[model samples]
Every structure is written in structure tokens, then in C-alpha cells.
Target: LAKTTQPISMDSYEGQEVNITCSHNNIATNDYITWYQQFPSQGPRFIIQGYKTKVTNEVASLFIPADRKSSTLSLPRVSLSDTAVYYCLVGDLNRDDKIIFGKGTRLHILP
Candidate 1:
């Protein structure tokens, strides 16, 4: 299964679009890729998820390759409030599992 990798940090001005990509080379068959956003001192909140192809919601768009080795989270018309840390979690839902957190990609939005 592919492990996940993401940028340590990113910066954007208000009203700009931000796209964060995560690479997972050995993702398992039963694993699902989920994206989350977090502010300082807070837990990550679910942003989006996908098994394959593309999935979009009011908050963001997720694009996954056919091989499922990587995924991207695209935030459009970003505002200062969008500045935060973004995380890509890869794991299976079945069985009792523990989710771990790493230093996520920090998105800084300039006012």
C-alpha cells in the first residue's frame, strides 16, 4: 500500500484558488482516501472523500487517478477563512482501526 505524502505548507492570497495534492503509492484495496481541514488547536474536519475518479461537494473538489495512487483537493475562490491545515487520511473502515495524524499541509491565506 502507498503511504501518503503532502506539501508541508502552502500560501495563497484571498480570492485565489488553492489546490493541495497528496501522493499515496501503496494505497490498499480496501482503503479509502479522505481529505480533512483543520485550524490551529482544533481537530481535522472531513472535507471530502473518494474511492476513484472525481468527487465534488460545496466545499471542494477531489480528483483521484485511475491507479488511485494520488488525489488532489481543489479549493475554489478561497478566502481568509479558508486558511488552515489540510490532511489526507488513508485507511480502511472495516475492523477496529486507529487513525493517526501527522504534520498536515498548512495552508496560509494572506488577507
Candidate 2:
């Protein structure tokens, strides 16, 4: 399995762009990087995903380099309501392997 590393916590203010980077040293070619965001008392929701290069959605953008060793999840103009925990998942969806989740990065959006 590919391991992910992220900061334990982050602090940002309203209307700020926050980028959380996740490192996966042993990521495989078929593994896709996926980002999820979870609120204090809610389930995690998919933010963005990418195999290579960059992928963007209304909520966020995912950037993966050619090496695929690391990925960055960018949240544009985040607000106080964006406070939550973000997780990075690296896995092959076509496989039946178990999913392992690393300790998520806690994000605090200030007023």
C-alpha cells in the first residue's frame, strides 16, 4: 500500500486559498490519488481525485506530478465553514485490496 503523509494541523482565514499536500513515496502507477474532507460529526466527502497531472471540480482541485509521488489538494477562497479534517487516499479502484486510511490533516478556518 502507498502511504500518505500530511501536516497534523493547519490554520487559515476566511477567503484564503489553502493547499494541503500529501506525500506518497511508494505510490503505484495504477493508484489514483483521492482527497476527502470530513466535518467534526459527519462522514467524509470526496473532494477531488486524479491519476496524473491536474483535476479540478467546483469544490477543490487535485494536482499530481508526473512521478505521482505526491499530490496537493487546493481549496480556493476557503471560508470559516471549511474547517474540517482532510484525508488523502492512494489506491487502485480496480483492485479488491483493503483500504487503509492515514491520520487525517486537521484544518481550521478562522474568522
lDDT of 2 by residue, 32-104 (tens): 8889999978999988889999999999998888898999999999998899999999999688657678998
**Candidate 1 Cα lDDT to native:** 0.88
Question: CA RMSD for every model?
Answer: 1.4, 0.8
lDDT for position 43 in model 2: 91
Residue range with the least summed lDDT across 10 consecutive positions in model 1: 93-102
lDDT of each: 0.88, 0.91
TM-score of predicted structure 2 = 0.97
Candidate 1 residue-wise lDDT, 2-103, digit = tens: 468999999999998899999888888888889999988897899999999999999999999999999999999999999899999888868445655556
Q: Top TM-score: which candidate number?
A: 2
Stretches > 4 Å off in candidate 2 = none
- Pairs in steric clash, model 2: none
Q: Which ten residues in a row have the lowest lDDT in candidate 2?
A: 92-101
